[model samples]
Target: MKKDIILAGVGGQGILTIAAILGQAAIKRGWHLKQAEVHGMSQRGGDVQSHLRLSDQPIWSDLIPFGGADMILSVEPMEALRYLPYLGKEGWIIANRTPFENIAVYPDLEKIYGEITRQPNHVLIDADTIAKDVKANRAMNIVVLGAAIKHIGFSVEEISDAIRDIFNRKGEKVVEDNLRALQAGIEAK
Candidate 1:
């Protein structure tokens, strides 16, 4: 099996955390994984994106060619649209409905969402709210990651374990909170 994913969001939104979790999981599954990341002023709310490729066999490159991605999992609505050019015909877009408006004049949210809905395959989630509801407001990124878990070629248990491994150093409470955030995303509408 293979998955070519583009993960997008602004800095400080846990975009890299999501990538780390997925990368760890990929390793556990004994899959070939390659990644390329672009960080834009992450400390100051700049754009951050990563290309993650996973397959049973060796992957020749880390970058995903345009129109070749299997999924675009974005933590920001606009960021999701930014990577549309990389999505394949049947690729799915699992994106949060929230917007991290760092620009002086952000586009109309409704219009941005309109474009996202126009896609044939998509799952738009209010991950921020879901994370808050789970009492893990800081884990919103994990929530988005959880929402896209179904399309990630890994089971919830598998990803949960990866979460545990990644957050083990932080403490059990942190781990459990993140797991709750993950479940919240999975149960999101």
Candidate 2:
């Protein structure tokens, strides 16, 4: 099986962290992977995106063609919409509802959300709020990652384990908080 996913968010929002955790999980499962990332002006709150392709067989390229992704897992709502051309007809968009408001003239939230929710397959999550709820506000990206649990091929255990492994070096409290944040993401409405 092959899966193409687009990870989107602003700089410093931990979009790369999500990619790293997913990479670790895929590695643990012995999957072949290709990833290409664009970390444009992240320090200036510019757009950040990564194209991640994983397969049971070999993956020849890192880039995913337009309209080929299985899902777009995003930590920012606008960033998710920015990649609509890459999203497949049956693709799922799992995105955070909150706006980062980096630009001077951001679009209206209602219209943006209306367009996003109107997509046949979309799940908008307030990952920041959820992370705060779990007392792991810094893990908002992880919370967004958690929201993609069902959409991705990895088992919940696989994801949870990956999180533990990723955060283990950070110490116990960090591990526990991230775990809770992941759970909150999974259980998000």
Candidate 3:
């Protein structure tokens, strides 16, 4: 089996962290994976995207072809819409319901969210709020990842282990908070 995923979010939202967590989990599962990142002036809060491909078999390319993605997993709502063209007909969109409005020309939230929910395969959650509730506001990315865990190819324990491994350097408190955030996201309605 294989999965083509588009990971998107604005700068400073820790999009690469998500890729790292997932990539680590992929490694634990013995899956062949390729990740291609588009920084897009990330430090300036411009669009940041990563294309991740995982397969049980050897993969050929790092790039996910147009309309070939199995899912667009985003940490920001608008960033999710920006990659809609990459999603195939049966593709799923798992995005945070929260908006990260750094620009003056940001579109209306209702319209964007309305469009997101209109899709049958979309899973929208307030990851930021969920993380905040767990007192780990910075772990919104993990919360978002947790919410989409059911959709991704990896099992929950694999990703959870990756999370512990990734945040262990920050000390036990950080790891505990992030784990709480992840659980909150998994149980999010």
Candidate 4:
């Protein structure tokens, strides 16, 4: 089986870190993986995206074709809409309900929320508040990942293991809090 996931956010939002953890988990699960990242002026909060492919077969490219993604994991609402065209009709979207201001005006959150809900497969999480509650607002990406894993065929324990491995040097409490955040996201909806 093959899965294509697109993760999007602005710079410093942990988009690449999220991709790395997912890739590591896929590796631990013994799946062939390929990942590509693009950061458009990421330093100033520009668009940052990662294309991740996990499959039982050998994968050649890290790029995800237009409308070829099975899942879209977005850390910000507007970024989720920006990558909407990449999701096929049957694709699932897991988005954080946070607003990332880029343009002079922010996008309409309620309208975007309504459109995403209409897709039937979309899952929205308040990752920002969740992360803040965990005292790691930066872990919002992991929160989004936790929500996204429900669509993918992975167990929560597997994801927790991956988180442990990824943040092994950050001390036990950090990993534990992240694990809790992940569980909170997974159990949401």
Could you arrange the candidates by lDDT from highest to lowest?
Answer: 1, 2, 3, 4
Q: Model 4, poorest ten-residue lDDT window?
A: 37-46
Of 2 and 4, the candidate ahead on lDDT is 2
Local distance difference test values of all predictions, in order = 0.91, 0.89, 0.88, 0.84
**Tens digit of lDDT per residue, candidate 3, span 39-66?**
5455587888999998889999999999
Model 2 Cα lDDT, one tens digit per residue, 38-73 = 744654678888999989899987899999999999
Off by over 4 Å in 1: 39-44
Score residue 62 of candidate 3 by CA lDDT: 90
Give residue 188's error in model 2 in angstroms: 0.7
Which of 2 and 4 is ahead in TM-score? 2
> Better model by lDDT, 1 or 4?
1
Alpha carbon deviation, residue 116, candidate 3 (Å): 0.6
lDDT (Cα) of model 3: 0.88
Residue pairs in clash, model 4: none
Distance from true location, Cα of 119 in model 1, Å: 0.7
For model 1, name the residue pairs that clash.
Answer: none
Please give the lDDT score at residue 100 for candidate 4: 82
Q: At residue 105, what lDDT does model 1 achieve?
A: 100
RMSD of 2: 1.2
Error of 4 at 73 (Å): 0.5
- Roughly what TM-score does model 4 have, to 2 decimal places? 0.93
